[model samples]
Target: MSPSTLQAPEIAMRPALRFITCGSVDDGKSTLIGRLLYERQLILDDQLSALERDSRRHGTAGEGVDFSLLLDGLEAEREQGITIDVAYRYFATARRSFIVADTPGHEQYTRNMVTGASNADLAVLLVDARKGLLDQTRRHAIIAAMLGIRHMVLAVNKIDLVDFDRAVFERIVAAFNDFAATLGFRTITAIPLSARFGDNVAERSQRTPWYAGPPLIDLLEQIDVEDDRSGKPFRMPVQWVNRPDASFRGFCGTIVSGAVKAGDEIVVLPSGRVTTVKEVLAPGADGKAETGDSVTLTLTEETDVARGDMLAAPRARPQVADQFAAHIVWMSPEALLPGRSYLMKVNHNSVLATVTDLKHRVDIQTLARLAAKTLSLNEVGVCNLSVARPIAVDAYADNRDTGGFVLIDRYSNETVAAGMIDFALRRATNIHRHAYTVNKAFRTALMHHKPAVLWFTGLPGSGKSTIANLVESGLHARGAHTMLLDGDNVRHGLNNDLGFTEADRVENIRRVAEVAKLMTEAGLIVLCSFISPFAAERRLAREMVQTGEFIEIFVDTPLEMCIVRDPKGLYRRALAGEIANFTGIGQPYERPEVPELHLLTPDRDPAQLAQDVIDELIRMKIL
Candidate 1:
């Protein structure tokens, strides 16, 4: 063969490495990524020219092109000279491809950083050579480890500014190693580089003669990115059920772990139904279905299959339970309220769930477990979660796809927290609902009236208790069986341990709601009077009873008017800072958008308001 026509030996391409850049703000993360892209010839000529021009106009670097400008695409980010969101960039070398995520470093934007690290296989943590390690460095390390990133590279950037001192670099490495030892990373490679000058990033630098290691790009190109899932037991969460016609019925989803072939015996989870795989139709594949393959599966016999169900190897099925222990990272500005119902979405399955207990909050700085009743924004905690129905799940260490979940606020539809399953609680599987012969209908018929809950909600001094007492008196005189659950009275007994914090308030309402529900089952009209400030908790209470069995009575007294009345001198104490987290003072009271009865307390007498509630109940035929 002619020399020009000679074919070179084929070299196996390396698997793409997914990594993220993180650390304290202005630690040269963006510049490092920009320099790496430039050295790899990823930036086009016109882009380079624009970058140079912009660098001269608004860059921090005096003469050189501001490489950070390439990645900080947001105008706000450019103006503030900080990364505000996760910026993903793609590039390639001759040996391998790479997906790099540049994450924010500010504590306020920790949620954004989590988004970047969720899918990464490795992390490149940048540190200013002058500022060895900051609090943000520890936080980023903790988050990266929580997300299951096992490998890390501590890039001490701006070494040139530190005069390439070997001692300085050694101190940084030692400090980081001391901290990282607790994080459980398998490998931590520390390298000194000046990203501004492109030194030791893509090529070796003579200035760092004392340090001998491969360049950053070289290390990334050679590191193994392969994670073998073929040896694991088969697991595929059904994302969609495809039934186009009578002849075709298939379960479709991407296999998350292991492999499956035709005639393999599989078990559907949470159902325990066993069947043989009739055929595996993996589109664009030769045959069979492997991990990461999106395929349609056919069963040998007709079975009850549905979306959100799991298909797994019969011998290694996941745990099916209604409750589990999990590690959660609360991401919402509103603190996490225990006992409040939220929408928990895991894979394709979404369930009504409640954070049953706040075990403890993790201190990112010291990794200490501190007792906490609530979790604020960016706080990590261990908690118990109870779902409305049992779900098939694996520990996060075993399967990220089936064990990770997000809690969404049902009313706002906002993601408030992310959680990883640890294990199913033993009690969750042991407990079963006991069926009784005498039910709500039977009790209600005997009482000659429908069982119902009249929920009174408003500000603390909005006459909720006054109106509720009057209504209860009227019901008792009319021979209607009734029970009253005033918030303060219940607090002195059932919820005395609870406080006024949002979390405690939620638990308090939950207890009262359960009590009211039980009372209603005995055919008594249960009356609840409390400043149930949050609408979500009120909605939860309403859902416990049957339709029209729960009535929301809003005592719409203005805050100024409540403060003027100060029924129990609470507003005075709250205003004087004697009490913290008091409703309508330190804490917020969410006004009911729509209530069954909205009584403007200041405009009417207590008797009139109570009569309105009784009249409404009579009109609804609940009396």
Candidate 2:
């Protein structure tokens, strides 16, 4: 039914409840939601007719109107008889209105479920009575809790399959309750129902006369999960700076928490510039706006406020820092490795962030803390991150809107993980960069030459180190200060702790880049030779130095050629199953899209390729 038609005088003032239904595959989440809407007479007549027709073609029920067809609307979902994405439906009762999201139950779609649960205040977790508390059922519940859902409904669905036995219902509820106790849910209500037959959904079931709890609809209507954010600290992220004419300048955004009024003192965050709210403009508002209200407010003065900045109560400002600890839910197929840079979008700001450390990963089955170097798909980990700049944030426990963030792959632009900030690291505020007077300019003047890092990257046995060494020897002969950092030589000293794993390879390149940056500052020509398989790390190394200070030299040797000319015999061992994560043999190598110099090494000698590198550096004016 339309909410306007069913709106009662007393219920008109009630806030809408947003919830999600999720569990393992084929646990009847869609069917339960469809039955609830159908029982309330919310479906239109034409929709009901379509459901009847579609039921015959794709129905799991035997010659009955398949209620699941209402929510499983996708063509793929209908063909497979399962939910692949989240489906949202709006409906109303005489007592309340609701927005319910039916999230997919498949394990591969766990990321989809996280998206659905991020905004829900309550989670109605379904479980097949016959198969009590499966792995995915626990996974969804844990994810719901991690996303700040405190209220839950443990709907023991398909009870008819287990004959509605009281013992069966109690056992399932007991197991869930035992596991959920550690999840920190505020309220968990257990109910037994048969969603297919519409028993104990909108009304109590006659078959299960032993159960005494209220029906699903009644429980949802009565459950109090309201979060009065208007009473908390005021926080509004600036989405736009509106200036239609010279006479007006306004900041426009939705108030994420607390309330605001004209003349209220506010501070622009990460800058801490204080100003007074001159006026509040909101449609149908009375000079005030609270949480969830999108409004524009003019400042008393021309303060430096821009998009991605936040306005907050002056005395209760959010934390501003560049380093923090957080819980991340890895979403991409590629594993999350430490030291790899990603773009993190928190609220309205996008910043370059790197996972500094992966403290521990949560064991999905046992929820135990285990030391881990990286996080795979659908895994949860506690990690430390360092952002490119300081950002205003609150702890996730204090304010979810400002504290939660998503990591986007810098190269692919794919969302790789969702993270919730725990707290800022104390060292972030304590450590400060000390300025030095004798800078790179002074060193360059004394040395009579510009400093640059010539980076050599290629497959193993591709003559990267030999070419780098030759170039450094030529520079040294020309009375230029030079240092050659070969991959094997540095691994034996500076990067001895690292191995051939992807995570270790990333760190190895990161450390070498920092060293190269330092050498450039000292006005010394630096030659770095490494098998930097990942393009992202090459980009990272390039960004570390000043413009025109980093030159990428790609020794383009075919993999087969490298395998045949393996002077170190590493490729043979790798192909013989003795070496793991060996680039070009076991681990995949991501070639550079565009390098400053691509010296094909198959037909040319190493000395000629080294001369090609020297010629390119001279052409780029780095020599």
Candidate 3:
């Protein structure tokens, strides 16, 4: 059934509590959740019989049924006896319904933990009673807090291993409280329990006579973490344009905050087009929709609204800008470097974005801000970002649905980082583009030729620069205004600050692309001779210019031949470990999947190869 058609009255009166269990490896997070299900009699008779058989083969509990088997359903997870992904289960009691996420504890799966915690209202952090506290325990707590989970429950599992010592439990609680003082959690409840033995899980156990607090399940049933999104300003991210036929048009999405009804004034964000709702189509008889309701609404006037556009109350609008600052959790094994382009996905909108600067990295150990140039895997940092176009957003503290985003690697399509928006940069609002009468067309007319960039790429000693020099000479002799940007020559001036690292190479290509773009505006035939290895950056360069204005010419030369020719001795140095991250030697070179021109230089002369590039440009009508 559609969510809009569901019985909303029951959900509104008593919503299910969403929570996650996270901690270091072997802290019994999955076992804790499984025990809750078992003790509450939520497991079926057949599943219990299967569990008993599987426990004998894969269970770590030795003689008894491994409760963790209930959640660790993956074959790989069962074989490895570890949680590698988030596992979710649903259960209910007379007091409440609950959805619990069992998140992995390994450092490599931190991204999985972040995904599970993103929508959770509370985090049930389990810790081994004998171990006290560990790095990953602290890391998970910090990430949960950053993702806007305001309530925390410290589940000190395996109290039976330590003979249910009250002092050990109190010491762990005190240490966590000290670190959590600045995390902004509204409540912190610590409980001692043995998930394997069912002590203090569903019901209070007499094992710890000194303990007076309620059991873990009772505390979860009574804790209140609702934020009352229905009482806030109306906001809905348009997920689709519902149009069955030409006779009707409607915007469809679930309301994330506040309420909307017929005749209510709404604004489409980023475009700021104002319109009134003509009709609301929902399950409710009143024709009104509030938070968590998926409905369709027709506008009174036709506005330029599309998917990714937000419908919001006119009086309380979200910030719209191309630049912002955010806290990021770097998830990829490849480090995040400033100035490299990435794809940012916020809501349904995807835009090209770059981390302009790494403001600082947060030390999980000390919570100190340390200066950093890059963020390694699992590192948390604050960064300033710039996007290709403006997007609507809200501060994460105000609205998570509109404020959270993920950065994706353009080539791999892997999610590299998760971010929480803080605010738009002041400079983004101040900077403005000035209009001019003399533009690219006027300059093209004055120069008497069309502008284009011939990007020559290949191995270092691939004769790219030698042929580019010849091409520029021919164009200049023909009175076609031209410029040559050799890779080595550029590093002496425009890219002097850059090194040979992968990150530096990405930034190097980015600056050269921008310069080439400006030179194209002046109606000059720009020749860029660089061994741009990564295909993503080369693609970025092509996209920066107008269609048909960028031509990629691949200089095909064998690696053995280049090593033998070694004009600059770069290959020898790279092979001897004198240089690092050198393309074709220390690092990988992603060959162009397709190119406009391919020149075989082993048998052909430099003059003939340069002629090939010129002929291709002529065929493109640039000559």
lDDT of each: 0.91, 0.91, 0.92
TM-score, candidate 2, is 0.98
In what order do the candidates fall by lDDT, top score first? 3, 2, 1
Candidate 3 lDDT: 0.92
The digit string of per-residue lDDT tens for model 3 on 1-623 reads 86544644444566799999999989999999989999999999999999999999999999998999999989999999999989999898656799999999999999999999999999999999999889999889989988999999999999999999999999999999999899999999999999999999999999998889999998988888889788989999999998899889999998999999998999999899999999989877277889999999899987888898899999999899999999999999999978788999997898999998899998898788999889999999999999999889999889988899999999899999999999999895777888778999999998888999999999889889999999998888789999999999999999999998877888999999999999999999999999999888898899999999999999989999999999988899999999888888898888888899988898999999888887887888898
Candidate 2: C-alpha RMSD after superposition: 2.0
Which candidate achieves the best TM-score against the true structure? 2
Model 2 misplaced regions, further than 4 Å: 1-9
Q: Taking the tens digit of each residue's C-alpha lDDT, what string does model 1 give over 1-623?
A: 85423422212447788999999999999999999999998999999999998888768888999999999999889888899989999997777788999999888898888889888999999999999899989888988988888899999999999999999999999999988888889889999999999989999999999989999999998887566566788999999999999999999999999999998999998899999999999766555979889999999999998899999999999988989999988999988989999999996999999999999998876789999999999899999999988899999878877888999999899999988999999884556778879987898888888889999999888899999999999999988999999998998999999888778889999999999999988999999999999999999999988899999999999899999999789899999999999999999989899899989977789999999999999999998
lDDT of 2 by residue, 46-74 (tens): 99999999999999998998899899989
TM-score of each: 0.96, 0.98, 0.96
Supply the global lDDT for candidate 1: 0.91
RMSD of each: 2.1, 2.0, 3.6
